[model samples]
Target: MDVIVSRSGGLAGLWVTWHVHVDEQPDRDDWYLLIRELPWEEPLPVPPEPDRYTYRIRCEPHEATLAERQLTGPWRTLVDRVQERSEPERGRPANGSDRTRPPSSRRPRRGC
Candidate 1:
C-alpha cells in the first residue's frame, strides 16, 4: 500500500507533498489501521479557515479523502505522524532514514 499526504492552502497557497510506501514502513500495519479509521466515503468539508492549511491524504491507492474537520481521532494521529516523519534532517532522507526515494520536483529535504 502507498500512503501520500499533501498539504495545501496556507496564506501563500504553496503545496507540500509527502509519501511513503507503507509496505516498507516500520509500522506498516498500524498505518493500515489508521487509514481504515478515516472517513473515506465522506467528501471533505469546506475549510473553516480559508487560509488554514488542509491536508489531502490518499491511502489505499488514492481512493480516500478527508477534510480538516474530520481530522479528529485516528485521522489526527495519522496526519501528525506523517508531518513529523516528513520533516527531513541534515543529511537525512525525506522519509527520515537512509532509504532513498524516487526523484521528484520537491525541494531537497533540508537539514536542521
Candidate 2:
C-alpha cells in the first residue's frame, strides 16, 4: 500500500507533500491499522478557511480532501505519522531550511 499526504494553502500558500510505501515501512501493520480507521467514506468538510491549510490524503483506491479544521483524531495521526516517517518532497528540506520550488514539472498545480 502507498499513502500520500499533501498540505497546502497556508499563509505562504506553499505545497508540502509526504509519501510512504507501507511495504517499505518497518511498522507496516501500524500504518495499515491507522489507514483502516479513517472515515474514508464520510463526506469531506466544506472548503477550507481563507489562508488556512488543507490536506489531501491518498491511499491507493481511497482519497480524501480535508480542511485544516477537519484534521483531528485519526486523520491527524495518520498525517503526522506519514510526515514523520517519510521525506518531505517538492523542495521542502528535512533540516528546516527555506522551502524552494523544484522544476515546474514537479510543482503542484492549484485546484483539483
Candidate 3:
C-alpha cells in the first residue's frame, strides 16, 4: 500500500493516497484511497455511503478508529510509518536518506 500526500492545487488540506480493501473474506476489498483533510473553514462533504469495500472517515482534531480495517496487518507498523513521516528531518543526513531503517515500515508497537 502506497501513501501519497499532495497539498497542491491551492488546496488547504492534505490528500492521503493509499489502498483500501473491504470484502467478505478477511481483508478482501482493495482499492486506492484518497483521503482529504480540509481546512477548518471548509464545509464537510456528505457522508460516504456504507459499503463493504470502501469508506470515508472524518475526525475532529484528526482522530478516528480503524480497528476493523486494521485486520490487514499489525498496528504498530501503521503507527511507526505515520510517525516517521510526521517528524522533522533535522537529525537525518538528508531528507529520506536514512539507511538503518526499522525492521518493518508498519506502525510501531503500542507498548514499545
Best by lDDT: 2
**In model 1, where do residues sit more than 4 Å from their true spots?**
61-69, 87-112
Error of 2 at 64 (Å): 0.4
What lDDT is obtained when candidate 1 is compared to the true structure? 0.58
lDDT per residue for candidate 1 within 3-47, as digits (tens), equals: 666665556555566766666678878877777777667656544
Against the unseen true structure, what C-alpha lDDT does each candidate score?
A: 0.58, 0.72, 0.26
* Each prediction's TM-score versus the true structure: 0.64, 0.77, 0.17
lDDT of 2 by residue, 1-112 (tens): 7787877666666677787777778988888788888998894665748778778888767888888889999999999998889877653333344332221223333221
- Model 3, range 1-112, lDDT digits (tens) per residue? 3331111111222223222212222422221121222222333342332322111222223322332243233233333333345432122212243322212213322210
Q: lDDT of candidate 3 vs native?
A: 0.26
- Candidate with better TM-score, 1 vs 3: 1
Per-residue error for 96 in candidate 1, Å, reads 30
* C-alpha RMSD values across all candidates: 9.6, 7.2, 16.3
Model 2: lDDT to the true structure: 0.72
